[model samples]
Target: MADSLRESAVGQLLRLVNRQWLPYPDERPEFQLPDYDTPIDQEKPADHISSIGPDHQPKRRSEGEEQDVEAFQLAKTATAERTVSRTLTPIRTSDGIVLVDWYTLDDPENPHNWSSPKKLLVSFEICMYSFAVYFGSSVYTSSIDGIIERSGVGVVTASLGFALYVLAYGIGPMLWSPLSEIPSIGRNSIYIATFSIYVLLCIPEALVDNFAGLMVLRFLLGFFGSPCLATGAATFQDMYAMIKMPYLLAFWAGAVTLGPALAPVVAGFSVVAKSWHWFAWEMLWLSGPIWLLMLFLLPETSAPNILLRRARRLRYLTSKAQLKSQSEIDQAHMSAREVAFDALIKPWQINALDPAVLFSTVYTALVYGIFNSFFESFPLVYPIIYDFNLGESNSVFLSVIVALMIAMPTYCFYYYYWVEPKVAKHGFGPPEQRLIPALFACFLVPVGLFIFAWTTRSSVHWIVSIIGVLLDIPQFAASLFAANDFARSSVACGCILFAHPMFVSIGVPGGISLLGGLTILCAGGLYILYFFGANLRARSKFAAK
Candidate 1:
């Protein structure tokens, strides 16, 4: 039965890939332009073929044999509207024909309407930005011992810096996400500005002489660097349709997961070869060019922002007072304080009150806290139990990356072939469908934790403990992805806030056992969501909006 299932899954995945590359044999032909070079009277209007009568005869043209210019223009406009109306918003032209809003259908400024290559390039850059910042967060873990030795702080105290940085980014997004969404400011501008400050803060973090200075700088670094984490997913909503979201988001989630997992490998080498401060230098060198690429190549993606620019240009040239984007018109009456409160404070209240958000927050928080605890526990378990060097100790994290590689494709296959087909058949089902991968993840989390907990004994092989760690990676990835997809951004902040205190109360081993138990409890919550999520969404005023 298992082998059969595996083969079926593989076949489904192949079909999915094939479909992406080549259309089905019976698919309708795409729209083609008419040969306008020939005089209007000499050529047949082939554009009207698709709109022919049921008898398979061409419809009579509104113009007689003289070839009416207005009739030809109307036919061309109608054809364009039919081709793009599903994806782009249509606005009536002065000639009584429709074109896409702000600009024509093929406008490069509209992120959603951009070419696939352009969208992929932007997604790649944003994922790189996310990877760089998250890498900085965990690279510090390998340097914890160096930090303790140099600053005369205990392991617990040094660990606080990591905890605080995580907490800061979680909270920082509440402030930054709102700012980034403003039509005048926009996604790319916030990315460039905050990221520049974030990189500059790293220098002081490396050079700081005291523990207090280190903590302060680390907190600021996370705070300034948070836009990538907070608003990165929102960029996808701007760029892709719902059907393509899962795959693109999986790529993004992979990059986010890889950053921390890959960090320790590099940091371990840096610590042994040079010093802990070298990790900081490494981050600086790596992140600088990413920032530059974003500044130069990443365009403004927010639709309101693009339209606002167009509105401004139209107002300048034509002096029309009524020409304004929906965002501008909506914000015209509200003060900045009102806008901020609605954007920032309202989301928090909704997240707090909503059952879906609360459950997702708890699950994501537990996963995040456990992942952080690994940094503290690994040194104790790997080096002391297995007698491995720093590099080998760090290489254990590669297992997490391997697990992620396996998990993402498997989830993609299941999602595309199984869940997506159901959704397509039924129309968008409950948000709980997003949690399907996460449900299995809940069981895996505990299974991995228990394995790690028992296998860390001196007699046990180190690979057993590594396997335990490996099991948690897919769960972590799945849970984070589900929560981000299903719950509000405020849930991310709540998870981070909750993670800091959890990590502080229990050291690594105790934390692992606690997380294992919590996973079982969270799994029950997932079951509730799976069964009742649609009903809850039905009752939610916020979900209605």
Candidate 2:
């Protein structure tokens, strides 16, 4: 009885950690075969082995892949037209390996097959997770004055705590994102573990008095909190249909936008009500519960990880040494040289060699850097010119979130009415079709900045400048995959490091107008890409043909 109790406790703990909703594949009666041994002789494992190249991994089929074209087409016709691609039949591969796959089209174990309510639950959880981390990034900005006064540091030195935090998270995904891709480690483990560390680090950050200690702790906080920022959309893609993705992603992107937008309001009031230490504590208050909720409910979402665990269970049950998932097979054959190149070199190569990638990276980095600059710029404008208190001054940031609310729904409407039908009829649209939204947004940014630049006087109504801030939210495809997360983020970090100093040197009017002019140039770049991007992609080796 005591042993059973102990075992029950251990099983519960495992369930909480893994949070995979279905039974282990080995434990299911359908998976157990009375005639399992009879089929063993008929399996031609060598044929499967010879088909795969040494360096080839089982990648998610791209739109360019022949086999996936029909699937993509079928996905658009109707809900009734959708069909499952993989089945329960064990595929024997090279070296006596049994490959594990979904039981059927409706297999609940497959994340894609999960019910709508369940998918929404997971989506909401991840969105909250993303919001908490991004909220941490700017919460410190409201407390910068407190830090400067207490530590006797200059404005720039105090702001480094915020700037370095941004840089650290950008650097972090280079390491953490790769670990999440490993089938055995998976997304949930990376998210929960790192977020736990992030939440705990907030305690130290809140308590630390020294400038150097505070800087280090802030950087650590951002580093540990980064996985969600980089991978949250990838999680959305794992379950949602491609046709349905823009709608869901619009919401996810809104969450990202609102995080920093809302941060100042909370931290601003908290700092004024109590001490600056409350800014750090507020992160814990926001994030600690989020971590607990994630621990209990956030299931492992990576399809590779789910199948890999299933393969392990099947191997143990059948007493077979070679039962594996495709991910496991790929992992086994991957060489150290390939790993290093994929992790370190490939993103830079694509960014450098592909014009489309370079354009998107530069455009998005400028947008983010300017957005980050607002954290510094807002206090300068509102408190000095408008005579608003810290909390009220910080509240101007609500305009960004207001803009986000408007922009997301607007994008969804455009995708549904404009983009979706064309894609449905044509199989998939050209890459330039994705840039249509950007064409509008790129032009809007310069207009918004110019309005903001000219309207900084007390004689001007604050709402006009706030309206300009509202319109400054630019839409672009951000780096979503684990492979390129670091590349995009690093560039954004560099821009962020430069943004504050540029604003300080030129003053807000000069600085804002300069950014406005830059966006006008970027707007011209967008127009060029819209017309010429296809030709650029055709010439590039990295781009899809």
Candidate 3:
């Protein structure tokens, strides 16, 4: 009876809570005579309440009782488990900690409860938005040649425009993303700032006197467009339920990876056939309306931000009304300044301090490099090998996109129809299911490479070489899923860690910067994913690490 009671309490506290939730179990012991400046009396429900020991007798526990905790409060409390994801539960104590949740499955507030039409609407809009915003981030690279020709900059110096743009992505999100949680200013401000910055960066492309200025401006353009690129960064929280997010993230994962590959095609044409400045102006025009639409249509997805706004409204009306405080707001949240500072340092700190996290970051960074190589190798391949002009060579890169389009649906079908049920039944995450597609992809890589490398000749039909691109379609998508799934899994310890402001509580991963580099990186990363995934099913330590 005692064991069952304890189990019941634990199960309620842990499992019945939000899927995004988990508490960091504190390992430390509590101090004796714990300081308490104030105490409030509470009415205990006679039915649910019980006293430990015989006849409901109560006494102050002595030294020996400390270790075992004769009753509940007898043990020195190091930490109490609170729901991790920081969702706004309805119940609240004076200090604002929720003692128990009254809501869980199918809660209307949960993104999972959103209507299918709404979900699809948001997903489609976001996809287009991400496509346009990300295009600006990398398409600017296509104009590098025209800028170099016009400004007479050397080759190495000219490439900085491309390098700097990527660097902006690494830097800007760290600063601007936190403001996304501030009320009325949240994601709206982020979009405005990012676009404003991008517009400012465009000035150099329009009026620069030298290559250096053009390079600097291009980098800045990417820096500003960064927040825009990263805007969908939190969409997973808004569009899908906890369990549902893994499947959707696969497509999100693909879109982010595919963006860099596709950009060179657009930039290639604008630079080769027209002036360099056209690329900047056209991209800006294309994305301008989408950004404006986001201001009004982008709903508040961060639950804390929504709660902060709700609390303010409650205070406005009902002068005699009371609002409950949550435990997290009291303990984990900080002033605006501290949050900004912490957000800047958090990704790097988490990556460095956690070995598992560090491995995942490095692994994904390689994927980014591989994706970027399309820009590098496309120019090299068509012009050097096939004698195609700059514009013509750039179009060839589109072959990879054709492959991605075909493969994307295959992956979606596998996950929704075949894998989601298994993940639910086994407590396994999306990463474990990621292997089936990735194994197919890994085998395709060499075959594709052989075809692409050997068949681009007049003697061979052009279609023969194109088969390699076909193989890469699946390779790109599946490899992308492996890196993201593994990194996301590790970031939470092993499966899904508790959500804190500092970590992935919510976020996702990036793409190609080479063939050999990406291939080697993919091989190594996926190999790790395969081995760990296999062992994970049999071992509990690795399962919940």
Candidate 4:
């Protein structure tokens, strides 16, 4: 009885682990589940010739009847096409190894063919994961003063906790994203593994006594939690067709933006109630549950990885040694230099040399930098000018969230009405067509800056300055043109480093005016790029077709 119970417990544990962490076939109910009692298999090829039902199956006709014969031929051709669609077309290598792929376009094993509700469940989980990870970056900032007092560190030294964390996460994707792409490694494994470490590290971070230990811990936390920021979009691409991806990605951007926006307020309140250590404790509390949720529910989303596992199963079942996944086959031929070029050099190559890419990268980096600059500038503006407490000052960051809420639906409507029709008809217009909305929105950044610069005072209502901050929140280009998220984050890190000093030296108004002036210059540059971008793309080798 004891031996039987042990075996059963082990079997259940294996099944649970396989279901949660491993790549497996999706078995979700179809959008329109078929009735099993229907005589689907008995239906003949020419039965579909009728518009109504198989009851209208062609009756026997005389041999001389040419019209009926022609209809039958068309029906046969249609049936052949349907048969081909369901068939498994195997890839054979030079050495005769069979490369496995989806059994059909509509294969349940393929992530793309999963039912809508299943895909949505996975998408929301990843977005929530992104929220928890990004929420860590600013949660520390809520208690920077507490850090300064407890650790005997200067404000500059304490600020390194935030700065280093941001910088490390930006650098992390170069390592993590590529690893996740490997068929054996896969996205789900990387997410749960690294995030578990990140969650555990929070405990040490909260207990650390010195500035150096805390900074290192924060950096580690950011580095491990970095995968969901960039790779989460890749997962969406795996499940969603191009037509639907833009809308889903818009939600993803909102999730990422919402995290940092809400974190400060929560952390600020916690810090006031408890101590700075509570910020890390709160991070642990937030992330630990998210990790548990992901471990149980986040199935592996990488198609290549799914196929690789399927290939392994096929090898076992069929007793064939030659079965391999496309990814494994490619990996066999791919050299170190090719991997390096793709992972490292290519993002920078296009980013630096292609005029369109450079313009997009710079624009995104600048906007992201400005966004990060807020964490620094808000401390200067709200607390000093408005004389608000910590929680109240951080509450103003909710304006960013408000701006995102306003911008998302408006962009969705524009994409549906304006962009989708063009794409559906012409199959994507000139790249310049994408810049149309940006051309109008670019001016708003500086407008918001100048408004905030001029209006942030004792005489003005705080809402007016927040409105200025709200105006500064126009950034569609960041998501559309971000070639490399880490590179952009690194640029934003530099901006974070620069912002506090600039705001301190120049005062809030002067510093903001300077930022506004710089954005105006960027707007002028964007105008030139919008009109002349094709000429620049014509000259470049690396521009996306």
Candidate 5:
């Protein structure tokens, strides 16, 4: 094939026909033209054939003449005369270069062949950094009451400490995601730098004497730390191969589910043993060393960064002289600036304008709102009822921890291994698989809510009340995972997925906190209602009814 392509007269003519616009395919194999404007190489255009001469000179004036002319044309321009001008070769793009893969896989630079240690390293780092961001968001659960008393801020204003952090969670990822697209600012660096800023921001909350200062610092910390939570999944998607993606996502999803569970435990110590100010101080102290360790241990997990390094190193090892620098590589297909802009705007815009995006965002956010609200309500619910001591206030969260350990794995098995495959087999988009987790959540959330709520009493044995609380965990975790899958699959860039927790954290409490007077009864009823609504929606989608 190579000799025929190289030596054929037709091949030489084809090369001559394209001129310098198409480079020699065997060596400098690039088309020096825009992607859309590049000449179609797959076939000869009818007009082109005519212009080039005999290939498609058409027929004659009459039937006999037409047949004779066709035969002559076919004879004159046989495949033997023509040769494929451009040789098949692969090139890299800035996107692919940084990611250590060819934008086109046949390039041999694909990351799929990366060592197992490297892939595992990237996955672990994503999990921990994601965990760190969640920690910043909810770690203050124990300190809210104390901060209010010491700072003299009203409950509504102080809640902003956490609210603003979560708000950043929504807002931060939007910008940071684009920022990470830059080959220079690796995702690992982004995690380290922003998380470091987060810890410092917390210091003021611990040390500051004024409410204004606390709010300002809290917001600042969140503003800086926002990317960790916001960009986690995208980071995950970029690293793991497709086959491992679901299970990897499941593991990270577990961290996300578990982050809140462990938060109360951290806060419990702060509230039970120390001043709220000191608690802040302690968290600040703790975050610094942890971040330092993360910085030292977590390598750059961003695909682009990995590729950029590999491309640079490979350039040195081989004689492939035209190894274009990262920016120079993909600029033909998309400039860094253009790529970043699209990455930033497309997700939010699609969610607002596209029904699938909006529906997924709305459903997941609503369900997630229910789950996260449970996290936000610790101070109010725990302190008042059960007359629980400081640490005991955080005990309510234990139910969640226990339940998630059970529920998350079960949902994992059902989604990645079962429902998802069924969806694929049936021609449903990945979002369709999300609907199944909804079934699990719908069944579990209400049952736990009613059990926990009605079971609550000074005399009914706190463990029984705790059981209801415990059951709520898996239900929420399962629902949350489902909602996330839907949001990610439906939204462009999975950007709306970024809002899942933000919307949930605020929405759940915004409604549920109002009904703490009937906490168990109301919560149970609400979970059941949402789950029921979710199931109906899922069935409707499946049945297309």
Candidate 6:
């Protein structure tokens, strides 16, 4: 009887151990490992919870030998369900697929998945805004005489206003570009806010009685109107896939070039018909419609921003504690100072230290400086030598527009048919390949500058000098566009800043001749890049990618 009592006690102990240490049959299925070879159609509950949840909290374990299996299983199941409830409520298809991206595959919130018509509309508005803002920057050049007379500033001092405006805008992007990338303040918001401020500032700029006030207002206008220069290309990247970007970017380039080309014509007539203030009013009128279009039409295109908004909405609706966007989650540990340093300081460092960036910047800067200098020199050449009025002098810039119209389409055909096909069949060619067209075009810049410099005399037909400008502008535009494609944002902006000072120092024919000589040196640099860019990129840590 004592032995039988002992056996019963042992059996009870064994049963108790099994119940505590091992889960029940129902719970086994929940914790079972998935098939390793097969694809997971449905995201497991645990996997979904872990991805979106806050960091797992530490729990204290009991030191006692015995534990409650039923309680543990119940707790785990509740935790998983709560996680599911709080995080992204993924759509599960009848075929067991889980869709957990920021939006449904066809969701309109994703810019990439936007309808073709919507994409076109947004692109058109962005291009138009870019055109208008750039036009505003250059229109003042046409009113230099008015500015000189009204402000009582010398011609050089009045020209300084334009130079400072360009410089300020170039630097402005260094700050605004980084800010626009933030989720809370996206591309659309930045564009809308700055462009509005830009439009308002134009009024003060127009009405300013002194050169100092005009200069200040001009600087502020450029500072506020910088988004189109800094972030416009990024917008295209955000909206379109790589396949469509070439054509879209080409179109954008054409629009941007058209701005400066058209500005002289429009402001020339406006200033002659009215006062210099009318030029500012013209800009205000043009910008007002652009501002409205952007406010209504431009959708937020940043992927991180969209995902962040979705995450916030889910958290609000579900009241889940740990739900976060991938960007938010990744950035959770980064300090504000670190973020600022990376965004603000790092770009300058890259521009300063990276050879590839330096070369590209130098090339583009040379082209830009020469192009802007034409504004000052064209009137000197055309009016005196050809006996033209301000309107006729301004009309000369039409050759640039014509050249752009011809060059853009031709380059697009070459890129789409020849260059892109090679890239497709083989791997990506070296960065040097981007400079091939630029190599040939760089030679034309010096040729055009020399031709225009020597031929701008009464003896030559007016067409000869215009032809010279025509050759240079198209070649410069084409080369700059190509180099820009390979350059970093900071590098491009820095180069633009460099151009402002170079163009401001006016010496007429002497300056033109100097620029022509400089073009020859720049052409040599282009050849070096064409031959050695690949090797340089391979060695550099921060080479263009």
Task: Point to the candidate with the largest TM-score.
Answer: 2
Kindly list the per-residue Cα lDDT of model 6 for residues 431-507, writing each as its tens digit. Answer: 68777877777777888888887787788798987887887876655433422322422333343334434434554
Q: Which regions in candidate 3 have their CA more than 4 angstroms from the true location?
A: 1-112, 178-185, 199-204, 207-209, 228-233, 320-328, 331-346, 429-433, 456-461, 477-521, 533-545
* Pairs that clash in candidate 1: none
- lDDT by residue (1-545, candidate 4, tens digit) is 22111112233246567633322332223332212122233233322211112222123423433454344334432342212233334544434465556665346556765556667878988888888888899888899999888878776677888878888888888888888888887887788778889999999988898878888898899899898875888989887767677798888888877787789989888799998898999888988888776766666778888788778766765567876676776777778889878877877787777878777777767767776875588988788888999999999878877889788898899999989877766876677887787788888888888999899889999999888878776463244226666767777778777888888898889988888887888788788888999898887777544
Stretches off by above 4 angstroms in model 4 are 1-85, 91-94, 476-481, 543-545
Per-residue lDDT tens digits for candidate 3, residues 51-85, read: 12221222233344343322222111112321222
C-alpha TM-score for every candidate: 0.77, 0.87, 0.68, 0.83, 0.66, 0.78
Output candidate 2 Cα RMSD: 5.0
- lDDT score of residue 28 within candidate 1: 20
lDDT of 2 at 501: 79
- Per-residue lDDT of candidate 1, residues 138-256 (tens digit): 78778888888988877667776666677677767777888888888788768878898988887877777788888888888878888888788888888776756888888888988
lDDT of candidates 1 onward, in order: 0.67, 0.72, 0.50, 0.73, 0.53, 0.66
**In model 6, which runs have C-alpha deviations exceeding 4 angstroms?**
1-100, 478-509, 541-545
Q: What value does the lDDT take at residue 16 in candidate 3? A: 48
Report, for all candidates in order, the number of backbone clashes: 0, 0, 18, 0, 17, 0
From the highest TM-score down, the ranking of the candidates is: 2, 4, 6, 1, 3, 5
Better of 2 and 6 by lDDT: 2
